[model samples]
Target: MSQSTHLPRTSLAALTLGAIGVVYGDIGTSPLYAFREALAQSAADGISRGEILGVLSLALWALILVVTLKYVLFLSRMDNNGEGGVLSLMALASRATGARWLLVLIFGATGAALFYGDAIITPALSVLSAVEGMRTIPGLEGMGEHTILITTTLVLVGLFALQPRGTASVAGLFGPVCLVWFAALAGLGLWHISRDPGVLAAFNPAWCLDFMESHGVTGLFVLGAVFLTVTGAEALIADMGHFGRQPIQLGWLVLVWPALTLNYLGQGALALHHLAVSEAHHQLMGNEDWFFLMAPDALRAPLVVLATLATIIASQAVITGAFSLSHQAIALGLLPRMTIRQTSAAQVGQIYMPAVNWGVLAGVIALVFGFRSSSSMAAAYGIAVTGTMVVTTCLSFIIAWKYWKWEPVWAALLIAPFLCLDLFFFGANILRVTEGGWVPLLVAAMVGTVIYTWLRGRRVSLERAREQGVAMADLAAALAVRPPVIVEGTAVFLTQDPEVAPSALLHNLKHNKALHRCSILLKVETVNTPWVDPAERVKLEVLDERFTRVRLRYGYMDKVDLPSDLARHPGPQGGGLLSAKGGTSFFVGRSAIRFARKPLLPRWMTVLYMFLHRNAADPTAYFAIPPNRVVELGSQIEL
Candidate 1:
C-alpha cells in the first residue's frame, strides 16, 4: 500500500500550535497544577531548591527522551498508512512478527482501554481546575464551591454535546487558538525569566544529578511526581498521523518544547526569589501562584477563560482518540465490531463510536462527582499514562531489533535507558492502584478480558465449523443432476470457508431452493498489506463444468470495494458469467452459533461464549454486503 501523503500541508507554525493544543493539552495543562500537587505529596524534611529545580530539569529530559526522541523522532515513522495509534502500530508489528502478534494485540488493546480511562479523567480534572478560579475571582467572595462545580459540570456537558457536530467544523480555529495558548504560557514564563535570569542555571544536567544524589529515595519518589509533566507526549505521537508527522514534529521542536521549558524556568524563578526574600516563602507554595501571577490582575479573568477553552480542546482530542482506538480494536479482531458510524466525511480521522462516547461520559461524570478536585483526579491519571508507556517501551524493543534491524548492542543501548525510566514510573504508579489509579486499571482489565476471550472463541468456533464442513466437490456433484433455470446473471455467495459448504447453501436449496441458471461462490480474504492489484484479484475456480467459485483478496487497510465498473473486466468464455440484461440477485448466509459448551478452553470461558454470541458483529456488515439482498441463514452451533 502506498503511504498517504494526503494530509493538509498547513504551515509548521499552525500545526505546532494545534499540536501543542491538541496533542499536548493534558500535560500542557498539567504544569498548571502538577508542581503544587508534588509539593503537597513531599515538600517537608530536607528537599532543597537545588533538588526542586533538579526535579523540574529531570522532567524536561524525560519529555525529550521518551517522547520527542523515542516516539516522535522514530516511532511515528512506523505508520500503517496514515494511521498512527497503538492498534495501528500493533498491526504493523503483526506483519513482521507473525503469530506473536497476539501479544502485541493484547498489549495494544490494554493500552487503548487505559486511554479510555485517561480520557474520562482528563475532562473531569481539566474543567474543575479551570473553574476553581471562581474561588480567586475578585468580588465573588461569597460564591460556594458547589456553585463552581455545578458550572464546571454544565460546561463539560456542553463540550460533549458539541461532539456530534464533529470537531473538524471548528478545527481550523484550533491551531490559531492553541498557538495563542502556548505563546501566552511561554511569554508569561519568559517575561518572568527576564526579571530573574538565574533560573536559567537549572537547565544544566548536573543540578538534576546533584538533587537526585542528595535526596536519595525521597528524590526517587519524585520520579512519579515529575512523570506527569511528560504524560501527553505519547498521545501526541499516537495522533501524529492525523496532523502529519513533519508538522507535529516541527510544532514540538519549534514551539511546544521551548515554550514548556520557559514556563518551568519562570516557575523556578518565582521559587528562587521567594527563598531569598522571605524565610517563610522558601517552601513549595512559595511559587504556587506563578502561573496565575503571570497575568496582570485585570486580565486574570480573561486568562482563566482562555485556560478553560484550552482544557476543553485538550479533552476533545482525547475523546476523539478513544473513538479511533475503539474502531481499530474491532478491525484487528481484539474486539467484536459494533455499529461503526463515520461522523465526518471530510475527515476520516474524525469518527464516533457511540459505545465508547457514552462509556467515557459515564466514567468522567463518576470521577467528577467522586473526586471533586483536580488534585485527586491526578492520582488516577498517571496509572494509564505510565502503563501505556511501559507497554510501548517493551514493544519498541522488539520492533527496533527485528523490524528496524538496529544493531543489537546499539538497540539495547537506545532502548534500555527509556525502559528503566518507564519501569520506575510503572513501579510508582502501581502504588497508586489502591489510590485513584484503580479506576483505569480495573477498566483496562475488564475490557481486555472481554476482547481477548471473544477473539479466542471466534477462532475456535471457526476451526470447529471448518472441521465439520463438507467439501465443495462433493456438494456440487451431488446437486449437479438438477435442471437449471434459464435465469439471467450469476448469484455470488460470500463466505470464508472457500470450498467448505456454507449451511446457508443447504437452507436455500430446501426453502428458496429454486436453482438459478448459474451461481458463483465469492470469498473475500483480507490480506496483511493495504492493497491488492487486480491481477491477484477475483481468481476464477471451475469446480467441475457446472459450478464456479471466485476469490478476491484484499489488504486489511483496503475497503472491500465491490466493483461498480464490472463492465470493464473480461467475461466468461462463451457467454459472460454476468448477464447485463437479466438482473443478478446476491444471496448471503449468516451462521447463528449457540454457546452451548463443546469442550473448548474452560467452563468459565464457555460462559464468555454466551456473551460473544450476543456481541458479534452481524454477518451482513462484516461481509460488506448491501443489507437488502443478504439473507441470514440461522444455524445452531455447539461451541
Candidate 2:
C-alpha cells in the first residue's frame, strides 16, 4: 500500500481524459455563476458597455495569470514527488524549511481547512444556479418552482450516496460528459461572439486599467466576484496526485482554459449587445438570472440539465479531494484515524471515506436550505477559496526559494504580483464577512483548531510514551536470560514506537505467560516526503534472531496495508512470510485516553482530543489487517 505513489501504467489519452473529468469540474461550472455574480456586483453603475468589457477583461486576465501561469505552469512543477495539494505541498515545503518556520506550516494547514469550507458551498451554489435555469426555460417559468430545492437536494443525496460504490466505471462517462460540456460552452460563446465582435476587445489590458482608474476602491471590491473565475485552479494542483502533471496541464491549456475564456467573453458580448439595445434595461438584465440569457430560448432546458450534471461532477471533484486530503491527514498524524475504503482495485486514487461523505452531505444540505438561492450563497463562496489561494501562493514562494533553489530576489519577483492579486481578492472578500462571507471563515477556524489540537495531542502522547515505556533492547536482554514459553505461530505486534515495548506485547506476555515462536515489534512511520521507496520501506533488526524490531516508513500519501506489506517479509532470520493466513495474529495497542488532573493542554483541548480518539477508526480496519486475525489491547492513558 505504501507503493501507492507509483503511477500506474496508463495511456496518455486516458490520463488526459481523466484529468479533464476531475481537475476541470470546478472551473468548468464557474461560467454559470461567476460572471453573473461579478456583473451583479457591478450593476450599481447600470451595467454599461465599459463595465461589461472591464469585467470580462479582468476575468480573462485572471484565467491567464492565476490559473494559466500561476497554477498550471508554475505550481504544478512544485509537486512533492508526483503528489500535490495543500497538505502534501506543506509536507514538501516543511522538509525544505525544516520545522523552524512554524507559521508557514500553520498557513499550509489553514489553507487545507479552508478548502473544506469551499467544498461545502460548491454543491449547493452550483446545483442551485444550474437548477435556477428552470426559471429561464419558456414554459417551465415558475411552474413547480418550489420543486427546485427538492430536486437539488435529491440530486445531492444521490451524489453523496454513490461514494461508497466508487467512481471508476462511471468515471468514463465523466470525460465524455465534460467534453460535451466544454464544447457546449465554446459553441454557445462562439454563437454570441460572432454577433458582437467588439467585446473581443476586452482582452486588452488598457480596458482593465481604465476601468480600474474610473472605479478605484469599488473596482477592488468587485475582484471578490472576479476571483471566482479561477477557483478551480487549485484543483489542478490538488488532483495532481490522481492524474499526474502533464495530463492536467494538457487538459487545462488545450481545452478548459480556452473554453472558459470564450464562454466568459461570449457572456460579456451578449450583455453588451443587450446594453447597446437599451441602457435603461441594463440594471435589470445584469443579474444572477442573466447567465441563462446567454443561451437561446429553445436550448435553455437542455443547457440546464448539462449545467446540473457539470455541477454535480464539480462537487464530485471536491468531495473526492476531501477524502484524499483526509486520508493524507491521518497518514501524517494531523487527524484522528478514519476508516478509508479502497473503492477500486484498478485505480489507487479512487477511495471513499463514509464519515467525510456524510459530513459533507450534511453541510451541503444545510447550505442549500439556509441560503436557498445561489445569489445568496455567492456571498459565502469567494472568501474561503481566495484565502486558500493566498496561502498557497505564499507557500509556493517558500518552495521556490528553499526547495526549487530559486534565488531570493528572483523568487520574490516571480511571486510578488501574484501575491498582490491574491491579497487584493482576499481583502475584498473580507469586507463581505458580515454578508455571509463568515461561513467559510468560521468553518476554516474550527477545522484549523482541530488540526492543530490533534497534532499537539499526538506530541503529548508520544512524550508520555517515551517517558513511561520500557526499551525493546532491555526487554530483549532480559528475555535472553529467562525466555518465556515460545508458542508455534507468528505474532505481529503493532506499536506506536518500535523502540519502546508495546502495551499489547506487555499485556500478551503478562496475561498469557507466553510468546510466539516468531515475534515482530512493528511500527509504521510517516515521513516528511510524499513517498518512501518500497525497497527502503521496511527496516528490520533481529533482536537475538527471534524477536525483531521492524519499522515501516511511509509517506503521507502512501496507502498502508499491514497484512500485504508484512507478507513480503520473513518472520525471523528470513525463515518464512510474517503473516500466514490463520496461522498469524496481529496485536494492536490502543489507549483509553483521558484528561490529566493537571493538564498540559487546556481542558477544552484535552476533551476534544479524547473525543476524537474515542471516535477514531480501529487500527485493524485502517491498516488493512484481517480483522479475524487481530487482537486489540487497551490501556488507560491520561493526557
Candidate 3:
C-alpha cells in the first residue's frame, strides 16, 4: 500500500468578518461599563477630574499595546496551521523546542481553562450593562434596579436557549446590527462630546499617570475598570483561524477599534461634563449620556430596542466563545470531549455544545442575579480577563521569539510594556475578590484541577492497559491453533501512533486469535485548520500478510470526514484493502481514576474529574465513527 496528499483553500475575508462578529463581541461591548467603574473608584477617593481622565488614558493605551500591537500585529502570525488559540500556540512552541514542550502545554492549557471563566463573565456583565439603560426608557421610567437585573437575567437565559439552533443563522443580522450598534455608541458619544469638547483631553497619557499617582493605592483598586477595555481581546487571537490574520486585523483597525475608542472617549467626555450625576444615574447614563441618551426622546424607545439587540450579539459572542474555548481545551486534554452539536451545516464555523451552553448560561445567570448590577459584575470580570491577557502576552513572547523568529530583544521590547500593563491590571483586580473578582479565579482553579486530574489519570490508564493487553504474536499463534469466529467484518483498529504496531493487534490475536481476511491500524491525525484534502485522505501501509497500517491526517479545523471516502483515496498501491465500504471500525475505549486521593490533589478535585469525564462526549461519537462499527473495551487504572 502507499500514501497520498492534498491542499485546502479558504476565504480570508469571510473568516475575518465572522471573527469580528463572533470573536470581538465580548471585548467590543466592554465600553458599556468600563469607564463607569473607573470613574466610580476615582470619585470614591476624592480624586479630581484629571485623575479620572488619566485612568481612561491608561485603559486606552492598554488596549492599543496589548490588543493591537501584541495580538494583531505580532501574535497572530504564530498561528499553527491556520489554527489560532492557546493550544495552537502551545503546539507551535512544542515544535520549536523539542524537549521543553511540557512547559508550554501546561501554560497553554491553564490559559485556555482561564478563558472559560472569561466566557462566562462577559455575557453576564455585557447584558446587565446594556439592559440597565431601561431606566432611561420613558414608559419604563422608575423601573427598580432589581427589576432591570431580573429582566436582563431572564433575557440572557432565553438567548442561551437558542444555542442548539446555532448562531450562524442569526449572525447575519448580528454583524450588521452590531455595526450599527457601535456606530450609534460612537455617534451618541460624539454628540455629547460635541456639546463639550473637554473630553478630548482624556486621550493624554499624563492624566492617567497623574490620576493613579493622586489616588495612591485607590488607583490600583480601580484596575478592575482598566481591565474592562480589553476583556474579550484574547478572543481575537484565540479565534484567529476563523477569519485568518487580515480581516480580524482590518476589523479591529478600521471598524471595531475606532468605534470602541470613540465610545470610550465619548463616555469620558460625558462623565466630566455631568459631574453632579448620582452614581445610579451615572450607572444608567455614564460619561456621554450613556450612548443611549444620544437618541431623541422620540427615538429612545427604538434605541432601547437596538441596545438590547447589541447586547444580545455581545452575549452570543460569549456563548460562541465557550464553544470554541471548550473545543481547544478538549483537544489539549484539559477537558473531556462533550457532545459537540454542529449548529450550522453550511458554516462549519457555527457549532454548539449542549453541556457548555447550559453550563455557561447557568453561570452567567447566577452572576447577574447574585451581583444584581454590572458594577459588581465588573469586579469579577477584570481579574480573569486581565489574567488571561497576561498569559496571552507571555505566550505571545514565546511565539514571537520562536515561531515568528523575531529577535529576542525586539520581542521583549514589544511585549514587555503590554505585560506590565496586564500585570498592573491583574494587581488592581486583586481587590475585586471580596467584591466580585473571586468568581472567575475560583472557576478557573476548579476547572484547571479537574482537567489536570482527568488527563493524568487517563495517561496512567493507557499505560496500565498497554501492560495488561496480550501481544500480537501470541494472538496469531493462538488463532493458528484454533481459529476463532470473526465478530465484525475486517475490524479496524484506530491507534494514536501510526508507526508503532497497535496494542489491539496483539490483544485480539491473544484473546480470540480470530483471523479476518483483512485488518487495518487506522490512524487519523487532525491537523490545525478545518478543511482536509482528498489527495491526502489516507496513507496505507501493509505490515504483514494479515496486518496493515493506515494513517489518515486531518486538520483540527476540518470536519470529521467519513472513512467511506477511503475508496477514493488513490495511492500507488491502489489505496489498500480496508477502504471504508466493507470494514467495521473497532475502537478500544479506556476509562479510569480513583475518587479519593489524599496525597496529591484534594478529594474534591478527584471527584470533579470523575464527574467531568463521565459526562464527556463518548469516544465513539467524538471520533465520528458510526456506533455499530465501534466496540468499547472499557478498563480503569489508578490515578
Candidate 4:
C-alpha cells in the first residue's frame, strides 16, 4: 500500500481543477463520438428507442463501474509512493513480492506497450471527431472531407511543434477551458433532456440487459464502441501523483461524472426526439452527429470550437503522458536511453521527449490519413485500451493479494468481477480486429517485441560482461601494489556493476598507464520506488586508500544528476569530493557491440538490440555530466 499525502484545503481546490483539465480530458471528449459510434453499430438494424436506451445504459454503467468504481475508488488507492501508473504499480508489486515476478513484468510491459498504441490513436480520433463537427455548422454544412483531414493534420502538427517550447504558459488555461467544456456538456445535455424526460430511463440497468438479449451478436459490436466512454479512465490513476486521490475523486464525483452522465443522457434524449420526428414524417432516420445537433443552430459553431479545444487539450495530455512514461521506462531499463528535455523549469513533470514526440506525431498522421474518418477510426480505438485495462486488473489482483495482505481467495473474489468486465470488453473489441482494430494490436506487438528484446539482450550482455570482467577488489589490490603513475585529479568511472572493474578504468590504466589520485567507481542504481530519501541516496564503500566504490541510489521517478549527487557526498579528507579545486573528470565506456560467435540471443534479436543500443542517447547527456570534463573510452564487445 502507498501512503497518501494530505493537502491543505485551499490547495485541494486548485489541484481538483487541474485534475478536471488533465485527468478528464480524454474521457471528456468521448461524448463527441462515443454515443454516435455505438448507435451507428446498430443503425443497420434501424434505430429504435430500445437500442438508444440500451447503448446509453451501457455507456453510463461503463463509466460508473470501470471509471468510478474500479479506477477512482479501488486502483487509485493502490499507488506507489503516491505515484500511480502501470510501471509504478509494477515496481510496487515487484517490491512487495520481494522479487521480479515474471508474470507481473509481462503485465506491466503489455499495459505500457498498449498505452503507446492508445497514445497514437487518441490524437487522431479526438481531433478528427471534433473537427467533423464542422459538418453541423450553418454555412459549413458542405465542408469537404479533405478540408476536415487537412485541418486536423495542421492542428496536430502545431500541437506537437509547440512541445519543445513547453505548455506551462498555457497549462493554467487548460483547467478553466475544460471546466467550461464540462459545464457546456451539462448544459447541452440538460436542454435536450427537457425535450424528452423519458430518455432518462436509460438509467435503468434493465435497458442494458434487454439491449444485449435483443441485439445478440450485433450488441457486441456496439459494446466495443461503448468502451470508448471510459477510454481515459486509466488517466485518473496514472495522474494521481500530480493531483492526489482526493482531488481527482472530488473532480470526478462532483463535476466530471455528473456532467458526463447528464450529457450522455441528453444525447439519448435528443436521439429519441429525432427518432420520433422521423417516424411521424414516415422517413428513415440514420446515424447523425447527435452531439453537435444537441445545440441550437446559432450556437452550433461555437460549441464546435469549444469541442475542438477540448480535444486538443485531451491530445496534449496523452502526448505529455507518453513522454513521462518513456522516461519511466528508460529509468526502469525497459527501454534504451533517449533525450529528455525539461519543458518547464517550475514543473518537473512538464517534459518533452523529441523521439517520442515526433514518432507519435508520425503515427497520428498515418492514422488520420489511413482511417480518413472518425467513424472508421473509432473501430480501432477500444482494443488497446481494453487490453491495458485487462492487464491493469491482473496487476491489481497481485497487489491486493501480496501488498495489501488480503487472503488470496478474498483478493480473487474482490478483483475477479473487474477482471471479467475488462476481459468481456477485450473480447468484444477482438471482434473488430479486421476492421481497423488491428492497428493498435499491430503497434502493441511491435513495441512489446522491442521491450522483450531489450530486456533479454541486457541480461545476456551483463552475463557476457561478467565472464570477461576483473573483480574490483582484485583490481584495487593490484593497483595499490603497482602504484601506477599518479595523476593530480579525481576520476569517476561510471559502471552498472561496482563489484566489477569498470571498462573505462581498465582502459585508462592500460593506455594512459596512469591513475588519478582519487578514483571513484560510481554506479547508479534505480530502486523499485518512485522517490528515494535524500539521506539514503549515496552509499560509500572504501575499496582501498586511493579507491572507493560509490553507489548512487535513485527511485525510478527521480531525476538523476551525477555531479550534483556526487557533490552531496563529503569526502574522506572533508569538503565535497566533486568540489575539489584539483578538478574532476568522468570516464564513460562506449561499446561497439556485435554478435558473439556463440550468441546467447537469436541472431535477429542480437541485431535489433545492437541497433537500439547504437541509437541510444549519449551517456554524457543522460547522466547530466559536463561534456567538457567527460572522457569516452571506446571498446569492441561481442555479445
Candidate 5:
C-alpha cells in the first residue's frame, strides 16, 4: 500500500488534488481535439446526428473500461512497495516467481520503450491542438497556420529549457491551475448540453454498435481516433507511488471523469445543434472545432489560453515521467548509467537527465515540424499508447496468477476480457500505421533493440568473467600462506560477484607486488523492492586475517552511497580495517571490451554493447565515492 494511505484527511485531499494535476493532465486535455478528430474520420459520408452520438459513446465507454476499470481500480493495487510502473511491476513479478523470467523482462521492456514513444508525441500533439484553438477566435479565424506553428514551437522550447532548473518552484500551482481547467471544461459542457438535450441519447451503448456495423472499415478509423480520450491513462498507475491509489481513484472518480464525460457530451450536443440549424437553412453541416466553439464568442480567447496552460502541464508531467522511468531502467541494469541530477533536495524523485531532456526535445521538435498540425500528428499518437496498454495487460495476468496467489484458471478468466479489449483497440490503431503511426513504432523498435543488446551483452560478459576468475576463498588462502609486503592502509574492491576475485585487486597486486594490511572485497546488489531496511543493508564475512568480504544490498529505487554506508556500519573485529591509520582507498575495474574470436553475439550487437560500456557513467561518480580517493584498473575483455 502507498504511504499516503495512512495520511490525515487534509493531506489526503492535497494528494488527491495533486493526482488531478499530474495524473490526469494528459487525459483531461483530450477535449481540445479528440471529438473533432474522431468525427472527422467518419464525416466522409456527411455529418449526421448518429455519427456524433456514436463517437461520443465510444469515447465515454473507453474511459470507463480502459482507464477506470483496468488502470484505476485493478492495476493500481498491484504495486511493489507502494511503487508502480513497468519496471517496478517487473521487479515484483520476478521476486514472486523467485527468478528473473525472460518473458516478464520482455514485457517490461516493451512497455517502457513504447512509453518513450508516447512521451515524445504527447507534447507535440497536445500543445499543437491547444494552440490551434486560436482559429476558433472570431477575428483570428484568418490566422495563418505558420503563426500557430511558430507559437507552439516557442512554447515547447521554453518548456524544455526550464527543465534543468526544475519544477519544484512552480509545482504547487499545477493542481490549482488544473482544477480551474477542469471546472471550465465542465462549465462549457453543461451549458452546451442544456441547449440540446436530444444529444443525451449518446449515453446508450447501442449507438456504438450501430455505427460500427453500418460504417465497417470507416468505423475502425474512427475507433482509432476515439482512443485519444484515454491516451494518458497509464499515468494513473505510474504515479501511484507519488500519490496513493485511494487519492488517485478519488480524484478521477469525483472530478476528472465527470468533467471529461461532460466535455465530450457537450461537444456532441453542440454538433447536434449545428446540424439542426444547417438542415433548417437547407445547407450542409461541416465538422467544426466544437470544443472551443462551445464557449461564447466573447470568452473564446481566454478559453484558448486556459487550454494552452493545461496542455503545457500535461507535457510537463510526461517529461518528468520519462526521467523517473529512465532512472529505474538504469538501476535494474536494463540501461546504461547516465548523469542524473537532483532538482530538489527534499524530493529524491525530482531528478533531471540532460541526455533524456535534450533527446526528447529534439524528437518533439521534429514531430511538430514534420506533421505540421495536430490533426496530422494524431495519426501517430494511439499506436504507442495502445501498444503500452497491451503490454501492461499481459504483465497484469502474470502478477495476478503468480504474485496475488490466484489460481491460473481464475486469473486467465479475470484478465481475458481486458486483454481482448486492449487487443481490439490495438487492432483499430494498427489501421493507421501508414497514416503516420509508423513513427512511434519505429521509435519503439530502436529503444527495444538497445535494451535487448545491453542485456545480452551483460550476460555474456559476466559468464566470461566467471570463467577466467579465481575463487575468493582460494585467493584468501594463498595470500595467507605467502604474505605480500604489507601496506599500512585499507583497500576496498568493488565487484558484482563477491565470491570471485575482483579483477582490479589481482592487477594491483601483480603490478605493485604488495597488498593492503586490511582489504575488503565489496559487492553492491540492487534488490527487487523499492527500499531496504538499514539494519539488513550490510552483511560481513571474514575470510582470513587480512581479507574480509562485505556485501551491500540496496533496493532498485534507493540512492547509493558507498562511503557513507561503510562509515555507518564498519566490519567486525572492532572495525580494524575501516579504522586503519590511513583512510580507505576504493578500487574499480575498468573493462575495455572487444569482439571475441568466436563472439557469442552477432558482430553488430557486440559493437553496440562496446559503445554502451564505453559511454556509461564512471563508477566513482555513480556510487558517490570520493573522486580523489578512487583508483581505476584497466583490462581488455572479449565479448
Candidate 6:
C-alpha cells in the first residue's frame, strides 16, 4: 500500500537503509537504558531467576504485538493519500462518519497534544542516559552527577541550535552508522548468550507467566518500564510518509527486531551469570547495568561514544516529528498559522517551525535541570507513549469499522486484544504519577485545552462574521446599476466566503469612492485530502466581464502562491485581469476581534484565543503575497 512500492529493487533497498536510520532511531537506542530500567524496576518484587526471565519475555512480546503487529502491519495501512499521522488518521476516520462523531475529534486532538509532551522529554532523557554511561568508565568514578548534567545540557543546546541549518548533508551517514549500532547490539548479546544459553528460555511466554505468579502485584509495576521498549512505535508511524511503508517494515523485521531482541536476551544472560557466580548477588540483583557491564573495560568507552551518538540521532527524529505535527495542526485549523520555513529544496518534508523549535528547547532544558538524571526522568517517559498507543487503538477501530467498511463486530473483535494490552501499559504507568510521571500529563492537559478552545472560538467567531456579510450576487447587481467611478488599474480582494462580498472590497468602495476596471475577489479553500490536482485547483467565475470571483482549492499539504498561480490565467474570467507589468494591489482585511457580551466559548478560552490571534503569523507572509503591492483594510468584529 506504500506509494513507492512499485519502485525498482535497488531504490527500495536504499530507502530501507534510510528508514532504519530515522524511523528506528528511538526504539533502537532503548536497549541502552530500557533493559537496565526494567531490571531496576524488578527490585520492587525482590530479585529472582523467574523475575528476570519474565521481564525479558514481556519486553519481547511487546515488540511483537504492539510494534510489529499493531503499527507496522495494521496502522501503516491507514494512510491518508500515502501520508500517516494522528491528524491524517483523524481526517480519514472522520470523513467516513461525518460530523456526528464528536468523540473521534476529541481523541484525535488529545493524541496529537500528548505528542508534544513526549517531544520535550525525549531529548532530555535520551541525552542524559547516554551521557550517564560515563559512570561505567574506569577512574571516572568520582566524575559524579554534576559532570553528566553539564555534558547533557551542552549537547542538547547545540543540537537544537543546529536545527535551522537542516539535516540533508549528514543524513546519509545516519543509516550506515545505525547499521553498525544494531550490529553491535546483536554481537554483544550473542557473546554473553554463548556464556550461558540457559537465559535464552525467556523467549517462551510461560516464563512471563511464572514471573508474574512469583511477584504478584509488584510485577504489574514492571510493565511501566517494560513499556519503554516500544516507545518508538508511534514515531515510526508518524514518519511513515518520509520513507513509505515497505521500507520501514523491511528494516524493522530484518535488522531492528532481531538486534533489539538479542541485546535484551544478552543482558538477561549476563545478569543470571553474575547472580550465580557472585556470593553478593543481593547487591547486584537489580543493579544490572549489564548492558555496558557485559563488555570488556577496553570497549566500554567506545560503546559510550556509540550510545551518545545514537541517542542524539534518536532525539533528532522526535524533534523533526514535532515540526511535522505542528505543520499538520496549522493546516487542520487546530492552531493559528505560524511561519513555516522550507529547509530543503529537494525534499518537501524537511521543514522548520521557529515556535515549535524554541518551545521544545525550553521544555527539554527545564526537564534536564529538574529531573537531574535519566533514571529520574525515565519515570515520566512511558505514560505519554502508552497513552498515545491507547488513543491510536480506539481511533484505528473507528477507521476499520467506518472507513475500511468492516463489520462492526469483526472490527471490535480484532482490535480488542490490542486495546487490552494498551490499557495494561497505561495502568502500569499510572502508578508512576508520584514518581515524576505527572510532568507530561500536565503539559498535555495545558496544550490540549488551548487547542480545543482556539478551534471552538474560531467556529463561533466565523458564524457571527458570516451573518453580517452581504451576498456577492446582490452586491454585484447593485454596483452594475449604481456604478462607482471606474478607475483603470486592477484590484484583488481576499475573502473567506466566496458567496459574500469581502469586507476589504466594501471598505475600499466606501472610502475611495472609486473602483478599478478589473476588480477580482479570490477565496482560498483547504481540502480534506493531502494533494490537490493543479488542473482542478483554481476555478474562475464570471460576474460581468469587469468583475470576477476566483476560487483556489488546495489540499492541506499544498502551499499557496497567489502571485504564481494567478500568473497562468491572464485577463478577466480565468484570463489575466491582473497584469505582471502594471499597478496591481492585493487588498486584505485585518480583523480586530472583541469578545461578545455573552461568550459562546468558556471565559478562559476567550482570553487564550485572543492572545494566540494577536501573536499568529501575518497573512501577508502566510499566503506568499508580495508585501510591496499589498493594502490592508481594518474591521472590528465582536464574537
Best by lDDT: 4
Candidate 2 lDDT, 19-118, residue by residue in tens: 8988899989999898888877778747777888888999999999888988989888888877888887888888888867997778778888898899
User: TM-score of every model?
Assistant: 0.89, 0.94, 0.87, 0.98, 0.98, 0.96
Model 1: colliding residue pairs: 16-251
In model 4, what is the error at residue 606, expressed in angstroms?
1.3
Q: Tens digit of lDDT per residue, candidate 3, span 1-639?
A: 000112123454555466666777777777777776777776653435676578778778777877888777877776776777776776667666653757777777778778878878878888888788777777887889878987887888899988887767678776677778777777876777787787778777787778777778877876667877877777776776666667677778987888888877777666665554544355432233255555667878777777777778878877777787777666545677788878886877688888888888888888888888887788888787777777777877887788778899998998898788778778888877898878988899878877787877566545655555555555445555666665445667776554544565555655765656566667776544344577776777765545567777665555664555554555333554445345655756455566424223456655666777677777677766678867665445344
- The lDDT of each candidate is 0.70, 0.85, 0.70, 0.92, 0.91, 0.85
TM-score: the better of candidates 3 and 4: 4
- Cα error, residue 265 of model 1, in Å, equals 1.6
After superposition, which runs of candidate 1 have C-alpha atoms over 4 Å from their true positions?
1-21, 44-48, 140-143, 276-290, 481-488, 517-586, 595-598, 601-603, 616-624
* Clash number for each model: 1, 0, 19, 0, 0, 5
Q: What is the lDDT of residue 365 in candidate 1?
A: 80
Candidate 6 is scored at a TM of: 0.96
lDDT of 5 by residue, 372-463 (tens): 99999998999999999899888888999999999999999989999999999899999999999999999999899999999999999888
Ranking by TM-score: 4, 5, 6, 2, 1, 3
Any residue pairs clashing in model 5, and if so which? none
RMSD of 1: 3.4
Q: Model 5, stretches more than 4 Å misplaced? A: 1-6
lDDT of 6 by residue, 1-639 (tens): 256678789988998999999999999998877877877887753467777788889999889999999998888888888888788787777777884798888877889888888999888988898888888888776777888889999999999999999888778988988999999999999999899899889989998788778776667778888998998898667877778888888999999999999999999998887777653644544465677887788898999999889888999999999998888888777878898888889988888889999999999999998999888889899988888888888989999999899999999999999999999899999899989899999989988987887788778777777888888889889989899998877788998777888888899989998888888799887766777788788788888856788888777677767777776665554446567234788999888778779777777777888888878898888889899989999987776
Compose the digit string of candidate 1's lDDT tens values, residues 275-295: 666646544333344466566
